[model samples]
Target: MDTVMQPDVLVIDDLQKHFGGLEIMRGVDLTIKQGERHALVGPNGAGKSTLFNLISGEHRPSGGRIYLRGQRISGLKPEQISRRGLTRSFQITNVFSRMSAFENIRIGVMARHGIRFNLYRRIKPMRAINDEAHALLQQVRLDHRADNLASDLTYSEQRALEIGMTLATGAEVILLDEPTAGMSRDETAYMVELIRQVTEGKTLMMVEHDMSVVFGLCDRISVLVYGRILATGTPEEIRSNQEVQSAYLGEEEEH
Candidate 1:
C-alpha cells in the first residue's frame, strides 16, 4: 500500500475585502506543499496585498477559510497566527529605528521563545534567546552589524535585518511582501541569494513585482488581476501565458 501526502497548507476558500461595493477578492483557493516556494504577482489594485494580509492574519477575511497544517486559522490575530509557525515581513521596513540591530532581532527571538512579556526577568539572563538571535543574524549575513543601530544600516542591510527578525521568530511558513523593494540591482541580487538560503526547507509565499526575482526564486507563480486569480503556473508557463501577457506583461512593456 502506498501512502498519500497531505498538503501542508491550504487556503480552502477566501473572499477578502470589498471597497465601495467592489470586490477585491472574489473567491480564492490555494494549496501549498511543504517546502514549496510560491509567488503571487498581479497588476496594481489586483489585491495581491489583500490576499497576503488575509493569509498572514493582518486582515480578517470577508468570507471563507484559511488552514495551516490542516488547522483552521481564519480570524486569528496576527500574533496568534505567528505563534502557529507562520510569519510575515511587510512591504515597508518595520524595525525599531532607535534600537541596535542585535536588539531588534533579540526582541523577535524573545517573542518566538514566548518571553516578550517577562518584564521582571533580565534579558541578559536569556542565553538561549541570545544564541538564537545571533544565529538568525548570521543566516542573513548581518551579524557583523549586530551592534549598529537599525537606522544607521544602509538600505540593503536594513532589509537583511528585517528578514533576520522574521527568522528569529522560528516560523515554518514565511510570507514576504516585496522583499527586494527599494533595492539596487546589486542589492536585489544579494537579497535573492539570502532569501533562498534562509527559506530552504520551508514554505515561502511572496507577493513580488519584480519578475526577475519571481522567476529566480519561486517554484510556482499565481497571477492576480481585478481581484481574482487569473492563473497559476510555473515561472516558464507564466512567462509564455497569453492571458498573463495581455493582463500584466503587455502593460509593463508599454510603460
Candidate 2:
C-alpha cells in the first residue's frame, strides 16, 4: 500500500521575470496544494503583484516555468489560464461601478457560461443567469443591495462584490492580491469571513500585508522579499522563524 500524493493545484518552478535593464523576479519557486489557504506576505516593492501578474498571464516570465495542476501554463493567455481553473483579483476594486450589483455579477455569470460579450441576443433572455446572479449576491451577503449601484456600496462591500465576481467564474484556484489592502479593522474582519465562506473547498493564494488577516485566514504562509521567497511555513512557524523575523516580520511589527 502506498500513500497517494495529491497534486498541487499551482506550481511556480524557479520562475523569473525581468525588465531589459533590471531583473524583478529571481528564481522564485512556490507550490500550493489543493484546498489550502495560502498567503504570500512581503514588503512593498517585493514584487508580490508581479508574481501574481506572471501567474495570471498578465506578464510572461523571463525564464523558468509555471504549472497549473502540473500542466505547463507559462505562455498561455490570461483567459486561457482562467478557463483552466485559475482566477485572479486586483488590489483595487474591480466591479462595474455604475452598474447595479446584479448587473456586475451577471457579466461574470456570462463569462462562466462561455458567453461572449458580442452575443447580446442570447444574454438578454437568460433566466438562469439572472437567478445565479441573485444567488451570488446572497452568498456574498449583498442581496440587500442587489439593485443598488456598485458606487453606492461601501469599500468593504465593493471588495465582497469583487469576490463574488471571482467565484462566479467557477474558478477552483483563486489568486487574490491584497484583498484587504485598504480596509479598516472591522472591514477586514468582515471580509475575512466573507472570503472564508466564498472559498470553501477551493485553493486560495493571497498576497497580503495585514498580519492579523493572514494569521487568521491562511493555513500556510510564504514570505517574499526583494522578489525572492525567504520562507514558507505555517502561521506558527512563520511567527517564530528567526530569519524571517529579522528579514521581514520584525520590520513590519515595529510599525
Candidate 3:
C-alpha cells in the first residue's frame, strides 16, 4: 500500500513541552498517516511516554500545535479528544477490578454508544450494547472469561481487555503505550498478533521498548532522545542509522 497517500490523522508541528524551566520536548515534528502502524522508540526518560500523554490530552503543550485530521486539538480536554476519535491505552492495564470482564467491556461499548450515563436503567436490558461487548470480547479471545471479574484474570488477559476497552471507544487514532510490557515471551507474541489483527485499517501510534516488536509491527519508526525526535524511517533504515545505533541500540548491544 502507498502509506503516504493516506491522510494525516495526526500532525505535530514543532511541538514543545516544558515543565517549570526544563524543556521536556524540544521542538519535535511528526506526522502520522491514516491506517499506519508507527512505533515511537526511545531509551528510558527519552519522553516516549510523555509524548503519548501529550497527544492524549493528559498534558498541554507549552508551545506548538497538534492537529487531528486538519483540526486543531492541542488544547482540548481528554474527554473531548476521546470524543474526537483519539483514544489511548496506558503502559499499565486500567480495568474495572470489581466488574466482570464482560461488564467492563460492556461499559466501554455503552460509553462509545453514548449511553454511559443512563441512570436508573439496567445495563442488562441493553441488548445491542451487550451483544457488541460480547463480540469485542470474542475478538480479543476473552469470551470464555466473560463472567470472570477483571481482578481474576491473568495479567495478559487483563491487558487484552484493556485493548478491547480502548477499541470500544470507536477511535480512529489509537495510542498504545507499551502494550506488551511485563509479558512473557509467549504472551508477548500472542499480544503482538492480537494487536496486529485488531488494528488493521486504523492509525496506531505505539511506544514500545522491545526492539523486536517495534521492528515487526511498525511501518515506520521514530527515535526519541531526551524529548526530541532524532530520526524517523522504515525499520531497516532505522536499524542501520548510525545515530540510532549509537544512541539506543548501542546500549542494547552492550547488555
Number of the top TM-score candidate = 3
Candidate 2 Cα errors over 4 Å, as ranges? 1-5, 117-124
Candidate 1, residue 67: Cα displacement in angstroms equals 0.9
Predicted candidate 3 versus true structure: per-residue lDDT over 1-255, tens digit per residue: 478798889999988999999889998999999999999999999899889888999999999999999999897899999989999998988999999999888877877888756789877777899999999999999999999999999999999999999998889899999999999999999999999999998999999999899999999999999988999988999999999999998988899
Model 2 lDDT per residue over 38-128, tens place: 9999888899999999999999899999999889999899999999889988898988999999888888887888887564476656798
What's the C-alpha lDDT at position 215 in model 1? 93
Give the TM-scores of the predictions, in the order they appear.
0.94, 0.95, 0.97
Evaluate all candidate structures by whole-model CA lDDT and list the values in order: 0.86, 0.89, 0.92
Q: Pull out the clashing pairs in model 1.
A: none
lDDT of 3 at 125: 77
The sequence of per-residue lDDT tens digits that candidate 1 reaches over residues 119-236 is: 7878887789888888888888888998999999998888889888888888999999999998889999999999999998888999899989999999889998987788888888
Candidate number with the higher lDDT (1 or 3): 3
Better candidate by lDDT, 2 or 3: 3
In TM-score terms, candidate 3 sits at: 0.97
- Cα RMSD, model 2: 2.4
Each prediction's Cα RMSD? Answer: 2.6, 2.4, 1.0
